[model samples]
Every structure is written in structure tokens, then in C-alpha cells.
Target: MPTSQPTPWGRARGAALGLVLVTVTAGALLGGCQQGQQRQQQGETRRQEQALQAAATAQRRDLDALVERCQAGQAELVTAAAALSAAEAALAGLEQRRYSPLPRPPAPDPAVLQRYSISDQELELERHQQALQAWEQEERGRRSRWREEQRQERQRLQARLQRQRQALSAANPAVLSPAPEAKLNREALAAFRSCKRETLASLGS
Candidate 1:
């Protein structure tokens, strides 16, 4: 037996159904692609966030280490300053003693003077002058030596202070801030700024 041919309306309905199926399939495929793109974008955003977080953490650790070093340098500076002050005081005392005049000897009685010297007091005056000269010579030598020692001490302390200052400057958080070209999120930037402020305050800079 021969099968009956489909009517125009039936054929049209079938075509419409096929078109709908095609449309639905296309729509599903497009939706899937959009969803995949969205997921990929989310993953990228997560990665960027993670990287920013890690950078911030590293920055904090670096700041902490630098601050520790700066504190240690400051302590060393304090010790050096104390030592310098003591050295200066000692030098000053030596200077005062060196400059101080010796006590003048009282004049001898008339009887003793006649027995020691015939008429002129020039002999006694010469002796007194010679003694003063000798004392001054000795004192000048001591002062010169003390001055040299003080100079050496001062130079040593000054060098130590300079080194400490350089160390502290190197450890400055502002100097150590992240690169300007770095892509950081708002939260990470805020964290970095906060850390810098705290570090500066702790270092008393």
C-alpha cells in the first residue's frame, strides 16, 4: 500500500517545529558560551585578587623586617651617643685641669732670704720661673695627647652615627613603597598605606 502525502499545513508545522528546535539549540549554545566566558572572567578576577593579596602580605613582611632593623640601628646610635658624651666630658675635664694655674708660693722670711740669697731675689725668681715653665711644658704635652685622643673618639662616634642614619634611611617605608606601575586593588592599596603609616610611627620618623 502507498503512504498518504503530508498536507501543506502539516508540513508547515513540522518546519516550524524544526526551526524552533534549531532556535532553542542555538540559544542554548550561546548561553553556554556566555556562561563559560563569565566563569573565565571570574577566575581571572580571583587570580588578580589573590596576587594583590600576596603582594600586600609580602610588603607587610618587608616593612616589619625593615622596621626591626631600623630599631636596632637606633639602639646602636643611642649607645654610640652615650659613649661620645662620656668621652667629651672626660676630655673637657682634662682641658680644665691642664689650663688651671698652679698655686703661687709664699715669699720667704727675711732671715731665710738673707741666708739663701745675698741681695737680689733674682735667683729665687729664676727658680720659680723655671718651675712654672716645666709645669707648663708637661701640661701642654698632656693636653696635646688628650686632644688627639678626643679627636679620634669623635671621629669614631661620628662615623657610627652616619652609618646608623644611612641604615635608617634605607629602611624607610616610604622609600620602600610598592612600584607605582603595579596593579593593586583598592583594599590592597589601603592595607599598604596603613602599614606604611604604622611603620613610620613605630620608627619615630
Candidate 2:
């Protein structure tokens, strides 16, 4: 019987070793898995052992397809998890200072400073400093009243992010899983990595 598939292994043969159907015959492939073959070949055999070999050979192709599907699903989950992590990091880095870091009040202008004597300059500096400090303190109080305003936006983003995380986890809790295990050919591995890269790139990262 001829090889069969949704994706022809012939096309991927060059890209993936030992993953091609056309390049490797069934007998050659089965030879590698022959531990109990000696016993099976004895005692009233009707080529059934070879039939089982062909069955296994066909099953392996099916397995290869499944491997690709598993990897693709995993790759999408990985990409989404990376995005959520980035969002969390950005949220943590949000500027949320309760006390407004008002800049140091500007110094007396150059022309004005040039006209003042040393004593006068000292007196002016002291007055200006006191005045700026008092103004800044009051300004901070005023600003503090509205500090939580931006906080509301941050909270909204956080809540939305949390909801998204929960929904995604509900869909596939494997996102938080330990080290993953999935069989992959060379092309499939490359495809999986490329999926992640394209996802990040689409997000403008």
C-alpha cells in the first residue's frame, strides 16, 4: 500500500531526518524495533508478524501528525503566557508614587542673581527656598487627593489582565505546567519556535 497523509512526509523529508515515509521503506523502519521478532516469526506464522509491522508503521505516521498538533497548541499557549508576563512586568513598573516628586524649584534667574550682593543673595535664597518648600508641600497635598485617580486606571488594567489570565488558564491550565514533553521533528520544532517569534513580533515587541 502507498503512504498516506494530510501533509506529505516526502515534502518534509529533507527538513526532518527519520521522519520521512517515502525515503524509508517499512522493512527498514521495522528492523530497528525487532526484539521479540524472533519468537513471532516461529510457530505457524502466516505473514501476520509482518502485517503487525506494517500496522505499527502506519501508526507511527499517525503519531507524527499528532506530534505536530500537540506542539502547535503548546506553542500558542507559550506565546500567550509570555505576553501576560510582559503585561504584569509593565504594570509593576507603573509610576505610582503617592507623594508627588515635585522637581526642585527653579533657581533665581542669572540676571537677577548677578545684581544681588552676597548677603542679599543669601537672604533671597533662604526666602525663596522656604516659599518653594511650602508651595510644594501644599501642591503635594492637592496632588495626593487625585493620586488614586491614576490608580483606578491601573486597577482596571490589572483586573482585566487578571480576568484574561484566569480565562486562558481555565482554557488550558497547562500554561503554568512544569517542563513540557512533546515529540517533535526538526521542522516541527522550528515551526513551533517560529510561531512564538511571530506572535511576539505581531505584538510590536
Candidate 3:
């Protein structure tokens, strides 16, 4: 018995069908890979945006902390100025007593510093002639030390502020809002401005 051979048309049709299947399969695979690549790119972009947001939030938190710390210290500056004013008034009154003129003023009244929480009680003596000389020497030593301590503290604060300024170029504009210290008395506000100017000046040095 003779087996029948396939016709040319039949073979051609079979090969065409195979080619169509191969083309469809290749297109599906390429499409799947493209979708996966797009998803990866989108995920990476989202992660970067999230990281930037977190960093900005952290920076704002740090800046707010600094603002609150400085605001809390405003009362201390006002109290110090008040205490100095009181001391000056008392000295003026003492100098007017020409009949028994005291050569030196006694230690400033420590009462003025009571509310300011100044704990030093060394100058808590009664203003009298007997201990006037001794009081002067003690006051001198205390004043000198206090000035040096305050200066160092100011320098430390200024240095931190300088670094903050440099680090916060992209900080929010709200950081420029006036602090609570702005409500202080004119003299005290001026003092704060002077202090800030000193801090800024240190940046150049």
C-alpha cells in the first residue's frame, strides 16, 4: 500500500500557523517584562520621595526645638535686666547720702534674683559698714566669674546656631516667624537682637 504525501498548501499552512504562535508568545513575554520594569521604576521613585519627606520632617522638628529652647530662655534675659536696673537704682540712692558717704556700694540685693532662681546666697548679707569691704571683694569675684560663664554659654549657643543656619538652607519659611521673645520689653528685645547679631558675626570669624 502507498502512503499519501502532504500537499504543498497543507505544509505551507502548518508552517504559517507555527510562526503565528511563536510571534504571539514572544509578544506576550515582552509585554510582561515591560510591565514589570515600569512597576520597579515607580516603586523606586516612591521610595525616594518618602525618604525626602522624612528628612524634611526631621529638619523641621530640630528647628522647632531650637526655637522653643530660645523662647523659654527669654524670661531669664528679662529678669537679669530687671535685676540690674534695681541694683543701679539702689546704688544711686546710696551715693546721694553725702553725710556718711560709703566709698563702695554693698553687694546687690539678692532679693531681686529670688524669682529668677539664682541660687547663689553668698551676697545675702545686710548692707552695712562693717562688712562693706569684704562684700566688695566677694562681689567682684562673683561678678567676674558670672560674666565669664555667661560669655562661654553665649558662645556655645552661637556656635550651634551657626551650624543650624548652614544646615537649613532649604528650611521652611515659617522658621522666620517672630519668636515669643519679640513680646518682651523694648530693652530686652534690643538685647536679644544684639545677642543674635553677635551670633551672626561669629559666623564670619
* Among all candidates shown, the one with the greatest TM-score: 1
Scored by lDDT, model 2 comes in at 0.60
- lDDT per residue as tens, model 1, 33-133: 99999999999999999999998898778777755654555554444434444654655664555334455455445676676755456677677678777
Q: Where is the poorest 10-residue window by lDDT in model 2?
A: 177-186
Please provide, for model 2 over 1-205, each residue's C-alpha lDDT reduced to its tens digit, 9 standing for 90 to 100: 9877646766576567665554587667677567357556663375777788898788667556645554557656556556566666767766543555656677788689779999988888888899898878978887876676668868977876675566445434533332232112234334344444443233222
After superposing all C-alphas onto the true structure, candidate 1 shows an RMSD in angstroms of: 13.7
Error of 2 at 81 (Å): 2.4
> In order, what lDDT does every prediction score?
0.60, 0.60, 0.55
The CA lDDT at 88 in model 3 is 45
Cα displacement (angstroms), candidate 2, residue 32, comes to 39
Model 2 TM-score (2 dp) = 0.37
| Residue 47 Cα positional deviation in candidate 3, in Å, after optimal superposition | 1.1
Model 1 stretches astray by more than 4 angstroms: 77-205
Better structure of 1 and 2 per TM-score: 1
Off by over 4 Å in 2: 1-79, 95-100, 106-130, 142-146, 177-205
